[model samples]
Target: MIEGRMETRTAILRAARTLFLERGYAGASVRSVASAAGVDAALPIHYFGTKQALFLEALPSMPDYQPLLEGDPDDLGERFVRYVLEEDGHLRPLYLTLLRASDAGAVGEQLRDLHETTFVAPLESRLAGQDAELRARLAAAVVGGLMYALWVVGDDQLLAKGEDDIIRRYGALLQHLIDDRL
Candidate 1:
């Protein structure tokens, strides 16, 4: 019974993650999650109490990005850029979901909180300037804009550039932000 319950929960969560990413919080419905999970619609409510709770539960644990930050100051930008560009990176989907769901009330608030705490806070701490937090946020905006162009907006011109060229050029931009030289 316990094993079956666990399987059901896992199925529900997997379905929820995919739907949340595909449809965002506003569009992903419990019935749809249940349909995707091959379970009854009520199953999610039984397991997670609410769609918001289910969404939170379905959110993957973020991978540690500290290695990117721990490298030499000069190389930190390249490292961070490369980490974000890695093939089949896991965090991208989570990030996309967060961005898409960011205006959906409580779930959006939680996603923003998770993003700031998990990703931005550490970067802010690494900065040395006055208003380091603000600088870090601005850096996030730059990086986020680039990411949106590449991943969300599908900007083909940006995508056509060779990886190394993008790294060298954009890495400098990121470096300037990280160093608080911007």
Candidate 2:
């Protein structure tokens, strides 16, 4: 029963994410998420309490970073660069939706909290004792910048380039900086 419930919750989150991304948060509705999840509208409310809560639950999963970082952290810089450049097209929609929703004040606070807790705090912990604050800020900036750049690339043809090419060209520079600095 517990496992089934967990799966249902996960499904709701996944569906909510897809719908929220497809139709900005303001455009997405509980009914849409429920229909996407193949569950009734009340189920999402029962599991997540609100659409904002559902969006927050799905935020961490948006970038799908686990596979990229699951292996050796030693090659993280290259892998990170590759992951974003390759997967950016698929991931940009979510970021666009989130940014729009965030700007609209629909989910700004929750998004900020999610970012601070999940990304900033973790980066701070990892870089502790080695210019912790600066490192944390840099890490956040790099990640956010990468996402934003990818978003821009979606609309701007002048920035056209493949993921592997981007990684091959700039990965070493970025990696060296990260490695040498920390």
Candidate 3:
């Protein structure tokens, strides 16, 4: 009975991920995801409490940024770019999903909270001097824009550039934002 419940929960989460990716937050409903998982609509609510909670659970876990933070400050930018482009490549689809659903009420709030906890807060802690919050947010924007351009928009020019070239160029920009004082 316990195993069965776990299976049902996993199925719901899996279905939620698929539907959320395909239809965005506003379009995908608990009923639809439950149907996709072959479960009753109430099951999702019973297990996850809310659609927003289910959506958050369905997202892939974020890559650890500790290594980048712990690394030499001089190389932090390049490390971060490489980490996102290579190590966290699998998260591109998830990022796209989040971007698509970002404007939805609950999802938008959750996204902001996630961003603050996952990116801004951690980076801000490491930053020194004035405008640390602004700098952290700027760095996050650079990464977000890169993901949008490369994965979402599929920019030809950016795609044409070798990964190394992008790392070197964008890395410098991120490094400046991270290390420069306001």
Candidate 4:
């Protein structure tokens, strides 16, 4: 019985993630997750209480960024871009879900918090000289734009660029932001 309950919970979480990514928080219903999980609709409610709760539960934990930060500072931007592109399919839905959330709501706040903790703070620490925070913000903005342009908007010209070209070109731009002086 305990095993079955655990399995059911796992299934619900997986289903919730897929549905949330596919349909967004507002778009993904408890019923839909339940259906996908092969459980009764009440089961999700029983486990998670509310759709918002379930959405939070389903959010992917941030991967350790330490390794990505370990390399030479000059290549950091390229490394970052490589990491971003390597993640291709995984992060698309995450950002998509963020966009789907209402800016004034709980989900939006959660996403914002995640962005700062998982992104900005780390970069701020790495950056040196005047206006580190501003530099970090600009660098983070470029990263966000790359994600939106390549994955979210699915721009052909930008997406079509070879990995080496991106690492050479976009990486340089990001690095410039990271080294901002004024």
TM-score of each: 0.87, 0.62, 0.86, 0.88
Angstrom error at residue 7, model 4: 3.2
RMSD to truth, every model: 2.0, 4.7, 2.3, 2.1
Tell me how candidate 2 scores on lDDT.
Answer: 0.68
Residue ranges of candidate 1 with Cα displaced over 4 Å: 1-3
Q: Residue 109 in candidate 2 has what lDDT?
A: 81
Screening candidate 1 with a backbone cut-off below 3 angstroms (N, C-alpha, C), the clashing residue pairs are none
Pairwise lDDT winner, candidates 3 and 4:
3
Q: lDDT winner among the candidates?
A: 3
Indicate whether candidate 1 or candidate 4 has the larger lDDT. 4
lDDT, each prediction = 0.81, 0.68, 0.87, 0.82
Off by over 4 Å in 2: 1-15, 34-48, 58-75, 88-93, 104-106, 124-130, 152-162, 180-182
lDDT of 1 at 176: 86
Worst 10 residues of 3 by lDDT: 87-96
Per-residue CA lDDT of model 4 for 1-182, tens digit only, reads: 99999999999999999898888887888999999999998999999888877888897775667677656877788888888878857677787787777463677778878878987898888877888888888888988889888777788887677877987888889888876723
State candidate 4's TM-score. Answer: 0.88
**Which residue segments of model 4 deviate by more than 4 Å?**
1-4, 102-104
Q: lDDT per residue, candidate 3, 27-81, as tens digits?
A: 8999999999999989999999988889988977766677678778888899899
Instruction: Give the CA lDDT, 0 to 100, for residue 182 in model 4.
Output: 33
Residue pairs whose backbone atoms clash in candidate 2:
none
